[model samples]
Target chain A: MGARRETILETIQQYVDLVATGSSADVVALYADGATVEDPVGSEVRTTREQIAEFYGALDGLEQSARLLHTRIAGNEAAFAFELVTKAGEQTYTLAPIDVMTFDDDGRILSMRAFWSGEDMLVS
Target chain B: MGARRETILETIQQYVDLVATGSSADVVALYADGATVEDPVGSEVRTTREQIAEFYGALDGLEQSARLLHTRIAGNEAAFAFELVTKAGEQTYTLAPIDVMTFDDDGRILSMRAFWSGEDMLVS
Candidate 1:
């Protein structure tokens, strides 16, 4: 009954798609102005748009595909697990991160925390 | 350098197993003295031993089975997806709730927040 869950779910899917195929700005657009992003949980949190954009910019020219595995949405927060396979020259890496996010009334992400560490990554 | 992820993982598995086969006291033992539990994100949070015991009392004397599906552990926090199947006489209810939790240094659960609503439940 907070933010529309349908809209939030749609936004999550859009986020995953953007992370896979869209630019850094496209991915950052899903977040509100003061939103914070902490990728891999224990890492330093990125607060500024430039920092967040740079974090996502790492995927700009990478060959990657993302697939959402499980999602649980309640109230104004959602935790979803997605698998990302990325190719860097001759190496392929796969990482599945479960992201917890809080959304604003308009379905813009307020904060995003990813639950995964380097040990969870698989290189092939 | 907080709580060991392996220990926390084992504790989570123990929790799911106890919720399926043990009593309320068994489940409550996993929590710290001032732990908080919010079974569903929007619901009221339960604190104190008596209140927490009362919350888990609902699972008592019911035919149930639980299986953990996905887990992501980072630092002293973990987010896991689990499947719970309960049978009330001729009716069967299945719910898959993704639970996010933080653990203390001793691996005791400090806070447990489940992300699932009645809409996510299935009856057969």
Candidate 2:
């Protein structure tokens, strides 16, 4: 929905919205073709366009919100500190951590590496 | 001593050596022009080539070692988790935090943002 480097901040916000709305395809488009996501508990999840579409399809009745606390941008990379409050199935989880996101010069998110602790997830 | 991208890891290692040896000039060259350094206590220190050289000239005696615990690289960006053990003036300080370094396509470090706590600095 936005051009390169012009709406980077908004692009990330859009992805957050998609997650909250349980729309994974929208979230996945922000990434480059060969994109990867790492979970808090040292899990590496690779995503393809089709896989992302299917993953979101499974989270049918989930409600989620990603609250952005702070954002720092320099050149082609941006770091965001955010909290994810999500309710999937019958339980809710809250995760607060900082994530480093790298964008290609064209503003497409090339990779996203999230940093958080498993202890926090367990407590949440 | 290395080419762009080929020795990104070695380049950072070299900077760590310069710090340990109190060779500020060598450390300063790793930064791009108009580079900035921030302290854990919320101080933004911008450095120019000349200022860095002068600063190193003053540190006649110092011993330091930046032991890298982990490094993650993706595309043109790299993040390093390291501990800086230094003895300067009559004091020794140990700072352990992960720093995100962005390198230009040419392998020159454009920006480095280190994430550490001020509390750690005071204790060390």
Candidate 3:
């Protein structure tokens, strides 16, 4: 909770950017040592660093672009809506996920829970 | 987590609607008897029905309009961003609060945590 507002916001942006243009390690680096990730909410949580990195490994290489639609930073927790577009050959799939993250005093993410499902995806 | 996606979404809409135009009791009715509300995340958690109603009492009689910008329902939980505009005399104040709620089988909200702070408010 000691993190400044700008610090938290910057981390969120960095997270989105890294997922779009960087390696899985880049995204995993944003989390604290004991962080957990539950992308899509109901999935099994990724607790260890190796597991967390593996979870993001799906985005290691792809034609994707991301942007933050809206964000709310409160205390050490943040909830944000973001858009991600993945291009595969002739089809383009878009999904907007609302991610909730709790951060530590050091500004590293403590836990991340994303609110999204296949029903929310749109392909064009 | 027994609630359907549609039911959860409907309850969220009803909540926003009641806050904008109905009485505090009307809004409190959407919650389960044991529901808890932690507005702005860092504030005190309101647990009892009377306490929760008291927290929302500030909006009992105000000229306000509310709308949901975007929402995501996963499992029995939903997270969304919405805007509330209050008009007093010639002044207008607006706030976009991102709310995360967990619903029961009957679609009654069990816990609602709002992710917003005073820094997110604006006046014009």
Candidate 4:
């Protein structure tokens, strides 16, 4: 269980690192095959490893950062609440981001579901 | 376990109903003693039952609504993902709200922690 917790932490750290460094490939590599991401309104976009990489690369200068508020783990899954903010040119924006992650027995992320404000992002 | 799940669901439904009906005292009655509510930045405000009632009264017609996206239960606990929106006259707001609930053996809410954006509310 300790190892599982550590792996979950490492997975989150790696995701953050990829965001900070603008490494789309590295970020996509963290997801398990057949993973699906959902927006706060329940719409989801499912993708494979390569598609996730392309999705990340499609954005330009997407500098995003988040402060994790809490993480609760139960068995092979974890739920995280975070305050996410982004910057593009002269505009700054903020949103509430919650990530639900499911890890396989080996501790790799088997699924990742993200919840965020799409309307806020669109208007911002 | 099924009874437990039903009780948990009803708790959440009652919360939503309180918000829509603007019944501050009704909402406060749902919390257990020593309940804590945390913002996305991790700052928490702990209040007793009467204090929670007063807190609700402090707001003027605070109309809020939420759509449950998904709910996952583990034993006596549950985690819910919801899309929360609020309307104050001419203004509209949306948030990604995640609720973590711990229930006592009696099926009453022992604790509830809410995650939302403080900055967005301030700015809006």
Candidate 5:
């Protein structure tokens, strides 16, 4: 891979790692000031930095772990498929989603859209 | 890769190949009867088979080609990133989109959602 692509992948991996480790602050720091996030593909978009931070912060309570399954990089965009396992209360849930994220020249995330549905999740 | 993952990838690759070769009918054949398609992430969803066929039919005119960049499969879902090059009139355009597709047990496509925007395209 080229250096630029390597950098983009590293940024995405860092985001995934932070999320897995429950570092909400660091996750929010990876985005650009006016970056937008739309989780679950069809939901309302979160535009402001504060809103984006809030979205990430919501994951704080859940015992979550993520495994990167695939990564594709082209230009300043990277799309990854990951499996997320979360333990909430006495239940454990698994979700597999494909998140397409675009980065700015400075490597900050510009937009994040996750494609997944209720049908994509499993509970145990 | 497991046998099931291999099958899913083959199905996705065949769909891409049909699109690249301008075989709209064959592309439509890959989907189930009530499949849906939402191109460009957020658009009017095409639900009926006729509408889905018509959507693929629209791609027949342009000299189009696609290259699969990445593929990920988990359960009955697969998401892939690909580069689409199209020659329209005297101009050539390139679009890179990540499309998340879900399939039924019979290997027929259930839904296709493409994640891309004007910012993700290039023209020459």
Candidate 6:
């Protein structure tokens, strides 16, 4: 991989690490001012920074964790597939999602879209 | 990886190979009867086998090729990121896309969604 591609992958890995660690603020900080996020593909896009932060914040109470399975980077875009597990009450839920992200020149995310459907979620 | 996961990856690799070889019929055969395809994320979803076949057929003239970059499989779902290059006239275009596919119990594809934007395309 080229240095630029390596850098983009590193940035994405950092974002994933923040998500796994429940660092909502750090996750939000990775986005550009006008960045947009659309989780689950067909959802409404969150445009403002505050909205984006709130979106990540919602996961803070879930005791969420993630494991990266694969990653690919090209230009300023990177996509990865990972498993996300969250504990809520007495139940645990698992989801496998593929997240595609585009970064600005400064390595801040311009957009993030996660592809997964309700059927892909497992609860135990 | 389990045997099932390996099989799923093999199926996906076959699908990618067909796309690279311009085997539209083979590509369509990989899908279930009512399989859907949504290319480029927010685009209209193509339902019905004929619609999906026509969609793949549209790429037959492009002299397209694909190089897989990363793949992840969980349950009956698999997602991969790859570079797609096509030659048209005197120009060559390259695009990096992440495709998420769901398979039924029989291993036929139930849906395929490609995540890519116009900005991800490069022409030379």
Candidate 3 iRMSD, 1 decimal: 0.7
TM-score of chain B of each: 0.97, 0.73, 0.97, 0.75, 0.92, 0.92
Clashes of each: 0, 0, 0, 0, 0, 0
Report the CAPRI category for model 4.
incorrect
Evaluate every candidate with DockQ and list the scores.
Answer: 0.82, 0.06, 0.89, 0.05, 0.09, 0.10
The true-versus-predicted C-alpha distance at residue B31 of model 5, in Å, is 11
- For model 5, residues B12-88, the per-residue Cα lDDT tens digits are 99988788785789999999888999885547899998888888888886788888976656567777878789998
Better of 2 and 4 by lDDT: 2
Q: Candidate 1 chain B TM?
A: 0.97
Q: Estimate the TM-score for candidate 4.
A: 0.49
Alpha-carbon deviation at A28 in model 4, angstroms = 0.8
Evaluate candidate 3 and give its CAPRI docking class based on DockQ: high
Model 6 global lDDT (CA atoms, 0 to 1): 0.79
Name every residue pair that clashes in candidate 6: none
How well does each candidate reproduce the native contacts, as fnat? 0.76, 0.00, 0.87, 0.00, 0.04, 0.04
- The best candidate in terms of TM-score: 3
Error of 4 at A114 (Å): 1.6
- Model 3 chain B: weakest 10-residue lDDT segment is B1-10
List residue ranges in candidate 4 displaced over 4 A: A1-3, A119-124, B1-124
Measured by DockQ, the strongest candidate is: 3
Clash-forming residue pairs, model 4: none
Error of 1 at A118 (Å): 1.9
User: Candidate 1 DockQ score?
Assistant: 0.82
Residues B13-69, model 2: lDDT tens digits? 776666667466667777777765543313455466675556555654666677775
> After best superposition, candidate 3 residue B55: deviation in angstroms?
0.8
Give TM-score values for chain A, per-prediction. 0.96, 0.75, 0.97, 0.77, 0.93, 0.91
lDDT for model 3 comes to: 0.92
TM-scores of the models, in the order given: 0.97, 0.48, 0.98, 0.49, 0.58, 0.58
